[model samples]
Target chain A: MPHDTAAHDTAARDTAARDTALPGAVAPGTAAGPAPVPAAADDGEQSLARLEAGLDALESAAVSDRRPWWRIVLSRLLPPAVALAAIVLVWDVLVWAHVRSGEIMLPGPGDVWNSLVAEWGPSRIGAAVWDSVYRAAIGFTASVLIGTVLGLLIARIAPLRAAVQPLLSGLQNLPSVAWVPIGIIWFGVSPATIYTVVLLGAVPSIAVGLIDGLDRVPPIYLRVGRNLGARGLDSVRFVLIPAALPGYVSGMKQGWAFAWRSLMAAELIAISPQLGPGVGQVMKFAQENLDLPLALGSIIIILIIGIGINQLFFAPLERRLLRTRGLSRS
Target chain B: MTLTIDEAAQARTLTETAVRLTGVTKRFGKQTGTPVLDGIDLAVAPGEFVCLLGASGCGKSTLLNLIAGLDPVSSGSIEVSGGRAALMFQESALFPWLTAAGNIELALRLRGVDKARRRTEAERLLRLVRLEGAAKKRAHELSGGMRQRVALARALAQQAAVLLMDEPFAALDAITRDVLHGELTALWQETGVTVLFVTHNVREAVRLGQRVVMLSSRPGRVAREWRVDIPQPRRIEDADVAELAREITDELHREITRHGRVGVDKGASGHAS
Candidate 1:
């Protein structure tokens, strides 16, 4: 009983001395007294090991360790919206101040808003955006799908990848607007013509993007995937597809821009009522009538649609992908 | 004591053996006089943790690649009792596009697990690796250890009874590497999967393996073997582990420093204490 009591008292004294001597609980006897210090350090070493184990437990990243769902949604939505609002407010102020001819060259926010409303009106562009949307969606969807298929066909098969690699690169650099003439010859003065223009313009972007993405995938991933018993289509779908999605998405974004521009260009050059009215056709009619607000309005609407799609759709998707990988933020 | 397992022994623990490489030889056959591995003979029993320790030119990776079925053996044959073996590399090599969970789920999908089951399996493996909450985390988002754990989960999702690890911890820092060693050791014990670990670090071999196999430096051969009898939860700095590593280090250094130079081992006594 005396021995136990003595050991307990010694431990209490040792712990108190340790607390007094060290910073944040390293044994005080370590630095103070040399004799019995090694003995003290044995305790310190054991404690240090416990501390290390605790740190491992504390710092380890858990798989379910995600922020709540709505928080993620808000975190993603807030930044882009703030930027968009800032831009809109600045434009409104500049136009209200007549900084760049609210009436002429840099039409004010109200003027742009008026154009937005007027265009979407029963007679004007309410119907027009739907046309552009349809054409844009169709063109973008088709190009994304077709270009991905083409890119995969080119990337995987050695002979095909080699043969079409240069062809794809060359196609990317060559402007799709240049293909308008060829498109006109093939599918002239109709919806087919506009769709053709969009196709020619957008397909290359998607295909080229997919190719680059595929090329960027590290060879180690393939080796590991193969070892994991994933092969052929299984490899491509699970490994290649997911691995290449970021690049593929970027390609889709670029292809969208091309398709939109191409459709507008086609509509402006060759107008037909059966072809459906779009921003381009509306802009053409407005310009002809000398209605500058309406013309400028149509242009603004197109820009807004593009901006909205990028900010609302693709930007969030990209952020989510990058953030999930812990690539974007620590 | 006995490496061989008899029929009754096999029946009692009837799990499939991990890997068997017989006369395994990998030869480029271009200008190099000999093949990478010459008549390599090796076998790993079920749930056995084996480490292949060799110097750089020994083609240890090539041997692993063959066992993994990533490359065909030039001469010998590799047999695994399970369906196939999954490989993990030095680089975590997690797919950048997918989240940590998504990456594991893809492995499940390829294994033809149902979509609903994949998420649960992925989550379960993540928990096994102590990365239970990092399901949505991406590759770069993780610290080195975290990424490795996620990758380990992904590798495990393949459901292969054999795991071929090619120096998977060579890139980590001392502290992170230590933690990972514990995690790996624990997981290996729990899973009962055979591990064929190839590494250059002698201490790492001592720390992780139940059996350590050393290959000769140039155009690798089975140089020596050590059966580790130390208890688990080992650290690299453990006196026994360090002592074994030192002995193997002498052999490894001798093989690495001299190419058949007759007994001029003057540097042995002069090494770090």
Candidate 2:
């Protein structure tokens, strides 16, 4: 039976090949027009493979090339370092030239550096930084969870989207610091007050970011997903989420900024013993004591933490996402 | 020579049809609106290559969408003997986040292909599309032709009995398009999957399809049909292919001119009033 089937298959293949070779021999509209056999013999297959490989190699050479790690690091670090040095030099020159008003004294860069190292111990500075970072982390994480769910709901449900879209945009535009007064009244100078302020500030922007991302996803991807047997949730998981990722990541970055700023504002205004000493509390203490160098040092620390977190975390993340998708040049 | 419309052929019943659409009509907005596809009755036999040719806005794509089950038909039924029809679009529509192999594997994974088997199966499909080395390349990294080939591989990974393609090669350069046409024909022959390819290009229809069906615009209906008797390895410049393409283009021109004159007459009367 095996031998007979093999012979029959060969005969069928030959007839198909003959039909292709001599097309007019078989009339059109014949449903039984023989199925064309795989015409690629071993030789033909090898040649085709060779041709395709050459084409791929030639074309892929134009694809984005990776710079060496050291080069990338140097490029990223050099310009910012130069700018910082230039600003410091200008500040030092002004102080040397005695450019000052009567009451407010602009501390020299060295004075600020000394305050950073000598006045506050390394452990104290670390603690202050840690406290603020911890609050920001918690607030941002909560905002991400809430924002993602809210965004997905609004994106999927038409009525919910229509109702909430305007309100969401309005909240995003409202300054998060404006919530500080309401939060203090509601929670009374506690961590709850700070967290409430942070949430209100960050959630709107994160949710809006996600909505915009979901909105920007091309209609074609959804059609392709449905056609490939992906039902409702499956479509969301496989197609919608990945396509919206770039936008979502950018949203998370903006949310972190808002969360950090809101936390600082709350800490400066609604301080309590239970809240502990964040960078904002330290800055407020320096202001009360009228210590110019300590105040300058605290401000610098705030700037460093903000820049450091974004540089260390979000920048790399956004870069990686864009690189993988070929959406970025470098 | 004027191509004959094989009316009997259109009505003929095939015992094993991959796709059967009977009186399929689709209207976009209101119930009273003229249908995008007016009573489209098409039956594609297993392993048959059918090209649906028409002018722009003739609803060739709408017909494919209806058959592929991406959109609902207003009045008629579509039955596919296969599990589901896989579709390919003009833009490739590949997920940018995924590599070529990942894209194909996603399709396989969706169809419930086992984890261990998916890798090998994806590799096999890539080879079938002559893209063995492009497994790791993302959609944007590959050339246009390569991306389309990857899209084709991903579609085939569905293991669908019928494949619906809507102007899949319309964006490529002429040389790339020609090369892809040969590859597509070869792939069709090897896989023996039923293809319902929609295109506005007449020569493309004659080059690839076993039968060409023309759709009339302004509520698209099957206006004419022609069986292409050209052999495999037929060129776009071949005498027989050109002859058939000229006849189809002439019919298409007439259809357009007729519509044009009616619009002009309406404008003239409206202006006078």
Give the alpha-carbon lDDT of every model. Answer: 0.77, 0.83
Put down candidate 1 lDDT per residue, A205-257, tens digits, no spaces.
Answer: 88888888888887888887787667888888778887788788888888888
Report the first chain's TM-score for all candidates.
0.72, 0.83
Per-residue lDDT of candidate 2, residues A107-205 (tens digit) = 899989988887566567678888999988999899999989998899889999999999998988887778778887888888888888899888988
Using TM-score as the measure, which candidate wins? Answer: 2
- Model 2: share of real contacts kept: 0.53
Please provide TM-scores, in order, for all candidate models, with all chains considered together.
Answer: 0.77, 0.88
Q: What is the lDDT of residue B259 in candidate 2?
A: 76
Best by lDDT: 2
Which residue pairs collide in model 2, if any?
A: none
| Model 1, span B1-273: residue lDDT tens | 354557657654335456878888888645367678888898888878999999998999988888888777778788886658888999999887778898898888888899999988887787666566568767776777778888899889999889889999999888888867876875776677789999999999999998999998667889999998887656789999999999999999988866545336554544524
